[model samples]
Target: MKFAQPWGRQRLSFLLEKAASREAQTWRGYVAKKQTSQDADVSPAQRDEAVRWLTELHGRLQLYPETLVLAVSILDRFLAPIKVRPKYLRCIAVACFFLAAKTCEEDECVPSLKELAASSNCGCSPSEILRMERLILDKLDWDLHTATALDFLHIFHAMATASRSGFLDSIGLNRSQHLGLLTRRLYACLADHALMQLRGSVLALALISLELETCCPDWLALTIDLLRKAQMDSSALIRSRELVSRSLSTPRASLPPNTVYIYHPLQLAAPARRPLGTMETPRDQPALPQAAAGEESKAPPPSPKHLAHLQKVPLRCKASTKRKVEQMDVDDFYDGIKRLYNEDATSAVHEGATPGGGAYSGGSSPCPPLQPVGAS
Candidate 1:
């Protein structure tokens, strides 16, 4: 005789509740008061630059999406209390991600320090990264299990799939397949810094709405109320849902096709798409030149393009260093992408197009209209 499965709606809810409590502990740790005197003098723009650098670095390394999320959470928690110069921030991010990989990824999957240095191009040395790792671990008192938005996603997905409900039937999806798509879309949202303030559960719940909304327009309002009952701030949940929705809808050339999500669990999903063979460093743009004996290399400052992308708001720099280009705030950037899709969808709707040709057309993946960011 077969044993009964221990999963169902009630069981899943109990698990989510437990995970939420654990996640709250992690959030409290993240939001703990920082010592003002030791806090970094850097602007939000500066911190965003560091986050962007890590985004590119994680992409090049072809690490799992959760690795990137864990790395960023680690970086922000470390940076919250200490003041480091702008130049050193990139090194700190590299170290944070490296440490995070060791915790979240398999031994063979984690990239070596030399590989990371080659991939990043920001001129961080292995020694510098190692030093930063030590500093981060000690500063946080050696706790590496900080809960992240991805953590909550795992619980939520398991619950939604455990039962054979009308919700899944109405959407016309396989439990595993849809969960994979949702996970990919969830990773896309983590790329933005604006939604970083929302809790992991709130973000996960919003993503559920985002995926379901394509088929069930009424689903979002219902989800909003459900999350509110779970003790999330209603206003914040709505705003987070919108941001997640926008990020998912944005069209980026770098997004992965849906096939990539079919084979693995979210935790061990395939690595992001990467550049062709050979991880050689470029000679012309070395960020850190080799140093003399007994000297450590300094962290290289961010490139102009990277800095501009992260600045979200315009800054008045000296003429010698100014960039004469239009500035798009982070919110506007995602919103702009979202708007493009909306126009196309609107036009298709007006034309009375069928499902395949319409905005909700099932293209490469049934996940969402939003593309998954490429591994690199």
Candidate 2:
């Protein structure tokens, strides 16, 4: 029998949407949690050490993306219920990764107990590894399939790049590549406990949304709507976006040399841009006045295009005494990007088929891979 195409546009779109929604629900429902008070009992230094070791172990194994994510989720779930002693942290982490490799990776890809112990130098006996795996399974009720932000991120990328000709839509070519890079960065950020407060869907959607604004402005509205349909919490989404933007916009000079190395070579090659989509004014245009000696300067009036963009977004008002004017300027800048999307939407749809889409950098590392556990 002749087989049908694996990915007709409609079929692929449906599959992507379904996968996104299912994974989003699974992550938010089963795995999402605030940093537990129990974590406080363990010194931040100890937690950081364990996380760093886990990162090295994961990299050395060359594990699949799903395996690394699953292992980390297991570690989080296990720690949430009961605090393990600091000394055994590496052993527990190893067992978690070992179990994850078995479940999510091919048999050939999974490492043997002896190999794992030697590589990590944790001195965990095979029997100890088995016992810890059993303990973790019992604590987690054997629910080893927790979805991660990377799960949703993959679905979103497929959807954004969906094409009938087995090629990525050119309109989103740059975006798809940039989104992949940002997604990897988010995974790197996962090593940080503060970012862990966000659920998978929120983090994935926020990073995707921001990249869409930067590289595929035309797709911004549709992506946002799909994300909202996927049940991303509104407040969480905003906070996640701000966090991503902040991290991306931070000056390289301000970041530690090691922190900068976590990014893919593409990210490392480019200088960081300002947050909130601030564009450089034409040099010929008059510069805006500085803020008055003590009081804040009034923001320049936004053009009509900027007003229209704000009209598209759901607005919120929170009263604050400090930096109120600066906040308004930031709001105006985002609104302008939304308007840019509206203007470019038609052109993007008409010229969808373009060869040679954006290229993604290989390999992944967490953002600022090493830092003081609670520095930020």
Query: Best by lDDT, which number?
Result: 1
lDDT of 1 at 307: 38
For each candidate in the order shown, give its overall lDDT on alpha carbons: 0.64, 0.62
In order of listing, the candidates' clash counts read 3, 2
Candidate 1 ranges with C-alpha deviation above 4 Å: 1-6, 28-40, 163-173, 217-229, 246-376
Task: Compose the digit string of candidate 2's lDDT tens values, residues 1-376.
Answer: 0112335556655755676665655443333334456543454445545665677787777777677777777787677656566667878989988988899887887899889988988877888988988998898788787667776676555555552213335444444455546555765666656566677767777777775665554655656665655655667777888876775565631343366445555545643443232333345766445554124423333445535554443333233444455566675665565455443332343232223322112233233223235855
> What would the C-alpha RMSD of candidate 1 be, to one decimal place?
33.3
C-alpha lDDT of candidate 1 relative to the true structure: 0.64
Q: Please give, for residues 1-376, the per-residue lDDT of candidate 1 as tens digits.
A: 0112436666666767787787777673334333354344545556666766677777677777778888878877787776677778788888988888898788999888898877887577898889889999999899978667776776555544443245777777856657667766665666555666777788887887666566554665556545754577778767877877776667741354342545654677743332221122335745444563115322222324533444343333222312212222333544455454453233334333344444443454456554546998
Please state the error at residue 58 of candidate 1 in Å: 3.0
